[model samples]
Target: MKKNIIFDLGGVLIDWNPRYFYRSVFNDDARMEDFLSTCCNSEWIVAMDAGLTAKENIARGQKTCPKYARELALYDEGWHHMFGGAIEGTVEILKDLKKAGTPLYALTNWSAEKFPWAKKNFPFLDLFEGIVVSGEEKVIKPNPEIYKRLLARYNLKAEDCVFIDDNAANVEAARALGMAGIRFTSPARLKEELSALDNRPSHK
Candidate 1:
């Protein structure tokens, strides 16, 4: 069977990092790193990924870390600055897959409130037959349930899907559910790896 391709948005297809935006704010790498690690870390942002509204996360962040109130507010207001841009190499691969009539789907850990902006800005997103968003589903990757949801919603068999994600844990989670999991490193590497799997059954 031709395997269905499922992609993770951030880190894989889109170049997104809070540091991209914060670099401008702090203008100092060390200061920015300190702030991100100490005050507004992944814990603070993961809440939004797990379905807490960005507005609510910002408010709570500001209340808890009053010293960085302005920065916290800017986190949401200037979230677009976080994008570096689409990974052109990977995008080209996506276009090729689409041209070949491959069934594509997207599973992303993103905020529900901000996903609309992503859909509007990234035209390449239209290539997907379906998308499963963590924020909307109130579930994030590395959790088996999120993977299960994607398979269930799409009526896809795990053994017939190719899951690609930048995070090792997320890839492992997909593998646990019987899907072929590829840990994204770069577009060239991904292209090579996928080609290697062309004649084989779905396997990591």
Candidate 2:
């Protein structure tokens, strides 16, 4: 049987980096990096991905670093600027998978409030048969529950799916759940991996 393919949205299909937009805000690269690393870091962003509302996230940031309250607010205020654009290479792969009649689903650790902007900007997201947003589900990846939720929601067997993610931790989590996991380094590598899997027997 053909394995169902699941994709992660940010960093994989989309070039999402806060630095892309923060450079303009801070003007100085060093300062921008410091602000991002200290105040609005990945840990804080993950909280938002785990279903914290924009308002709450911003407030939490402001409370943590009162000095950068104004800058912290910009996270939600200028959220749309964060996305650089679609990763055309991965998107091409997705299109190819779709054309080949592969079952496609998205399991993304994305903020519910910001996901709409992404959906509007990236039309390729519409190609997925279904997408499970972490923010919407109140869970985040590298956590087994979110992966289990995706499998259950889609009526998919974990052993019959391939999960692709840019984060190694997320990939490991998927593997732990019995789904073949690919730590996507590049679209070219992913294409090669998928081709290799195509010829191999399914994992028991």
Candidate 3:
């Protein structure tokens, strides 16, 4: 049987810059420090990915500090830019996986707003068998609950799938659940890793 391959969006498929917005919106050292301290963690984005509306999230950003509202709106608008670049070899790798009949999915922690930007920018994702975003599911990664939900959704055994993620914590969570998980070091390395798996049963 072919194994399912799950991808994380931000780092695995779409290139992400951790400080893109801060660089764009903040010129002050103090405000930048404050912004980074208050509104820059994955949790805030995860909350939106887990189903909080973008409008509300902008408000949430604003509530963090009066200066944040405008920047937050820019954050929402520039999300496409935030996640615009594709991993160099990802398209080819995904194509090969499809050719080999491996079931493919993407499990990313992104808000409901992400779909529009992603679909508009990288519409090819519609080709995948499943795409789960935590914002849509109200769950986020590195939390055991999200991995369980993915397993349950596909009715898949924990060991029957391989998860690829850039974050060590998320990858470790998948492994802890008995799934095969690999760290995504880079697009080139990712292709090398997935191609190496062709020697396994799923590739056959």
Q: Which predicted model would earn the best lDDT?
A: 1
Report lDDT per candidate: 0.92, 0.91, 0.78
- Which residue pairs come into collision in candidate 3? 49-110, 49-111, 49-134, 49-135, 50-135, 50-138, 51-135
lDDT by residue for model 1 (1-204), tens? 578999999999999989989988989898788789877898899899999997899899998888888888899877998999999999999999999989999999999989999999999999999999999999999899998998889899998899999999999999999998999999999998889878665446
Candidate 2, residues 57-88: lDDT per residue as tens digits? 88988998898899888888777888788899
How many residue pairs clash in all the candidates, one count each? 0, 0, 7
lDDT of 1 at 139: 90
* Least well predicted 10-residue stretch by lDDT in candidate 3: 195-204
TM-score of 1: 0.95
Error of 3 at 117 (Å): 2.8
- Give the root-mean-square deviation of each candidate in angstroms: 2.0, 1.3, 3.0
* TM-score of each predicted structure versus truth: 0.95, 0.96, 0.84
* lDDT leaderboard ranking: 1, 2, 3
